[model samples]
Target chain A: MSTVLQSLSTELADAVESAGRAVVAIHARRRIPASGVHWQPGVVVATNHTINRDENITLTLPDGTTAPASLAGRDPSTDLAVLKLAGQSLPVASLRRDAPPKIGELVIALGRPGPGLTASWGVVSRADGPWRTWQGAEIDSLLRLDLAIYDGFSGGPLIDAAGRVLGINTSALARGVPVTIPIATVERIVTELLERGNIRRAYLGIGTQPVRVPESLARKLELKSDLALLIVSLESGGPADRDGLLLGDVLLELDGTAVNDASDVLAKLGGDRVGKPLAARLIRGGQVKALQLTPGERPTSRAA
Target chain B: MTASMTAGLAQEVAAAVDQLRQITVQVRTHRAATGAGILWNGGEPEGPGLVITNAHVVEGERATVELSDGTAARARLVARDLRRDLAALEFEPGRAVVGAVVRDSPPLRVGELVIALGHPGGLTGAATLGIIHRAESDREGRTPRWIRADVRLAPGFSGGPLADATGRLVGVNTMMQGGLALAIPAVAVEAWVRRSQTMAVS
Candidate 1:
């Protein structure tokens, strides 16, 4: 090999060595095996979809020792779960918040599918986002890897050529698409889970679905999107109903944010907007009407 | 890896790619398969011409072996050990292919550099670089069952060679676990092939 290639491989090998140390092999399910990476000193972040039972989880440390872990919190919308290892100290993977890896840059995915640390190499296919998954989960950062995910790959760390973690890759939210939940998203989710135990969402008390807006009305309204929310049902005297929103009224925007679909509305109704008066613009018949609604506390009974 | 769709490789190819490709074969099973194989004659005086691949690569009893130079041959299943995912095929030694150089590289340590040569996802002659993630026996003390590496092996990479930095075959790329490439070690492949040939002779 040329000196340049040798140097590249050697450097990459070093990165995987340090980063793989933070990767833990998680046997989240009694039957199915998965992987998790340490986000904090004792906190491991994993994909929520694989955690069948809420309790009695096991994590295989890089040293090959088993330790009991308890689920701290889980957000199904984003498919991320946090597990706290009992009295165990594991190496925390360093999250790179600086410049992102450029497109075409080499990336490696590390996981503990078995007792051993397994690796997969790919390239950063799509790295720009503050996008939402198809399930309507709001992600602060998004990464679509060119890498193909296999068994136990969900919840593993996706590292750049330098070994810095890009995010936690999960198959849950992507619906078979390879998506990586970036480090910033992992940090945010883990913080919320550690502090509040769950992501707080605002309640609209209305069921809605995405519908296409009439071209004539959309152009006159100077709307940027072709999709709008069609209100299906209002929870008796709920936020939308109380705010003078009638059934069948098309929702265009909430607090200046476009409500293109049900997920878009859900994405806007985050916990921060709860108890806040939000200006909602909707098209009733052929006219666009603006109304004010104070978002209420979301019921904990509602599954994400 | 969404940065760019790299048809050739996710990472850059090194100086050893040409050497690696010569011994690599795009091993396609008659069961409608996608896999890579290594051309190994084993220096056997009688019926030594063989193609080494994963047991799962071949279906029924027949397969089409495409050599590195694009020569295709019809091969018959010789022997297989499903437990280890290793199998051998007897074919006419038409291509002057040499067995992969088996180096003395042993005690495979984590973070050691390696490369994988295979036809991943039907993209023939693709290569990926990685490190030896782990190399060990299972709980049953099965020595060198798998060589776990970070090198990406997609649907078509199975049965290819996972070689060391020097381009010597160390393992036969097989299945994947959690996206990591799993391979049957070269030593294990040699043993399996030797045992299968002896059985065929008897």
Candidate 2:
């Protein structure tokens, strides 16, 4: 090869190598109850609930070595898992701090999409309203990616061009939208899962429905015009029932803060409220009553 | 080795890339749902006839692999390290083929020579060359630890081999940016593969 040609060839080769290293793939095979089976993408962060002895998992690197990864800890409340790799010096992901991704920032999702490490780039289309996931948990903040989320990129990192991870690619909106768990939320969940066996969550065993305070009802009971969490069904031994709460009670406030919606109550109760007392104010039969309830440990489902 | 020898070795290895074809993978149930390509190396699926691709290629799948030649088979998926992104595919049936040797040290400084081989764009056997821009860890960026070169990588180039002027397996061609390509340092991959194998056995 001529000197110039050799130099050119060398430069091209180096570029190919560097770009390949940043790409990582996560894979998982999940068995959904009643749904039969489901496939997951990206690196499988095996949780105690999902990865079992009969299940199989493999982790692949940029250079293409595949190894079976074992299950670590899994906290379903947060949907986080810790996977230990016998492998080391594996290229760690770049974490973005200081500033969260702006709502319109362009981000890239890389994983073994459809079989090999592939890159899918998109912009933040919207950072909007909370949505309840399939697990029946509500997320207050979320990022909407423009690209379509394929099945295999779940646990893979959604990174910026500078290579900082913004979040973990989670699910895609069936309506042509992709969703990722924000890095801040993921960090908190992962930290909790690693430190504790499970995510500590406060629970009130009552099914709630958000009802707009009627003008007539508001006038009769001095209620706000905004939405309020209405107690629908109270579990027999729940904290709300033990705190002298009634079935027809309209929740007005929690912990001295006015409640605007059902999600507001969930936010106050779910995280940072485990094993603590919350003062709940409610209106029953046109009478206002204040009750202090000491929330108890959430009941664990037997499924996982 | 001398610079001339290194250059010659690169040519020899580059030439060998022409004979290499196909990477084997076993797509797990979840991986298969993502709609991935199949590596077809001919012959039987079992025995020594397996394909070898990047470990990431077969993530979320349980699999064993075979090389292009019908002579080698390896047990796959013993252990994996997420930090390094390396996995060891092991099989008891086939003889262990001696893979290409890699240099122990990092690549030469900026503007030095480098080369890569892989099925870029599904081109079963191809060789491309480029120059090193710098020697830096991947932590500074999102790309993997590699020799950042000016090589171009099309689709399907991942898990390919990268060599220095001496034909040593210095890195594994993995990704590309514009015209810049990245390769995982061979020493790093080798070290992790060995370590994962130990854990798989014990």
Candidate 3:
């Protein structure tokens, strides 16, 4: 018993010590607190939602010192962003390249939200995903954590018991619900954001609102979700306008994924789908209609 | 997608969860205030036992305790210390209630294995595991000094037990302090219970 306890103690202590070195606190506008990982030398990856402004970014490193960081790029579709610092190089977190973590294994979310490191431990609540968020952006994997993502943990790493970072935990895009943006997705988004300033998203050029699908129509179309998107307006000369999409149509499905709300349509509008012809199924005049329309590039006028 | 349930650690955790399930129960107060509490002997088994929880989780003067087997009875709020965030509820003895043997807590070092049982987010009988981060005194060195641990606790987890790897209750899961999950040492809770018992007898 003594031996078992001692071995476990050593493992956990080492995990915390090594992982803490890479966790840094990020402060954006209004002093909104967050955590980030030193994935690459002098490159910190954090969540985009907690970061309201790109200018005047500051980071608190593990050595108990602060440094000014510059925003390199950010992609809100995946809720990930990158920052560059001219400060000293920190040891990058070791990421496990082995099999994906099991559902019930021990995992810890660590961050230096303040002067010292703060840790939260729990099991992987759920790890099954090749699914898409409501924004319709592709997520390589979805990892739901039972651990609490407290004030400074939004961008922290959810590492295994061995201290290998599994993913960047963020609740920003998930509406405060903890979801891990996996390493594969993080690398892809960071590369694109660094090159393009923002990830391109396809748009149908229609402002829509969520409304309940009439029960009669739902049963007729065999739709899974009871809600649909009702077109309120359109960007003149945009994809929907060019396709003669009416203003009163309620979107039921886009590219086979059921559109439950405005977010559902927006989710599938990510840059990868831009310029591709997509099948939009809508209910016009109480009848399900299918239309072929090529998605246009999403406007970049919204403030970050 | 794959099972990491190796034979050794999986067996140990399963056994501990089984032992913990026997003593854990749900505490309910008015206006839907709910949390987890542990059953313990108030003084003697023949006398009514008490359900221990956090003072901030005190739902009302008369709180309902639901046992593991789903039996419930209203427990009287016998004593409460808000300063320590500890509360003890005396209720009728049903069957036999086993109290958790809390360790001295000092011998526990940083990174020692620990498990927590609580009703977090309204879900009862939930258990999560972590390690002790290290115990430290607050700035003022006043009451409610804590041994912070890595075990995660949500809103409904307040007033529950942070047990050792062997399932012995070592601390009461309180709130977060200094960015870590904080718990009141079991010695503090035991001392509070002793004072409450002495006061009742006097």
Between candidates 2 and 3, the one scoring higher on TM-score is 3
Q: What is the DockQ of each candidate?
A: 0.27, 0.03, 0.15
Instruction: Tell me the deviation in Å of residue B28 in model 3.
Output: 20
**What is the lDDT, from 0 to 100, of the residue A45 in candidate 1?**
94
Off by over 4 Å in 1: A1-10, A209-229, A256-260, A281-290, A301-304, B1-15, B21-99, B108-136, B139-142, B146-161, B172-183, B192-202
Between the candidate structures 2 and 3, which one is better when assessed by lDDT? Answer: 3
Poorest lDDT segment (10 consecutive residues) of candidate 2 chain B: B31-40
Candidate 3 residue-wise lDDT, A210-264, digit = tens: 8998788789888788888889998889999999898988888889888766767
* Model 2 per-residue lDDT tens digits across residues B29-80: 2322211112322233444322333556557435534344533333445454
Rank order (by DockQ, best first): 1, 3, 2
Q: Give the DockQ-based CAPRI class for model 1.
A: acceptable
Candidate 2 lDDT over residue span A1-304, tens digit each: 3444345435434432333354444345443210000012222332233333333655555555665554445655444455555543454555676666767675666544322344445578877666655444555457777754433445556666455666666543223345766666666665665566466667887777887777777787776555777888898888878877778788888998877766677667665677789988887776778888777767664334
| DockQ winner between candidates 1 and 3 | 1
Query: Using Cα atoms with residue i matched to residue i, what is each candidate's TM-score against the true structure?
Result: 0.76, 0.50, 0.64
After superposition, candidate 2 runs with Cα above 4 Å error: A1-24, A30-56, A113-115, A127-141, A172-176, A212-217, A301-304, B1-202
Cα RMSD to the true fold for all candidates: 5.8, 17.1, 8.7
User: In candidate 1, what are the lDDT values of residues B72-133, reduced to their tens digit?
Assistant: 88888888878877778878866455778765445565656788888876688898777776
lDDT of 3 by residue, B1-202 (tens): 1244345566677677767766777888884747888777633556677888988888568888888777888789999888888889988866667777777644554446788888877687888777876434434334447878876667777877788776778888889665467888887788888889899889
How well does chain A score by TM in each candidate? 0.86, 0.75, 0.82
User: Per model, how many backbone clashes are there?
Assistant: 13, 64, 5
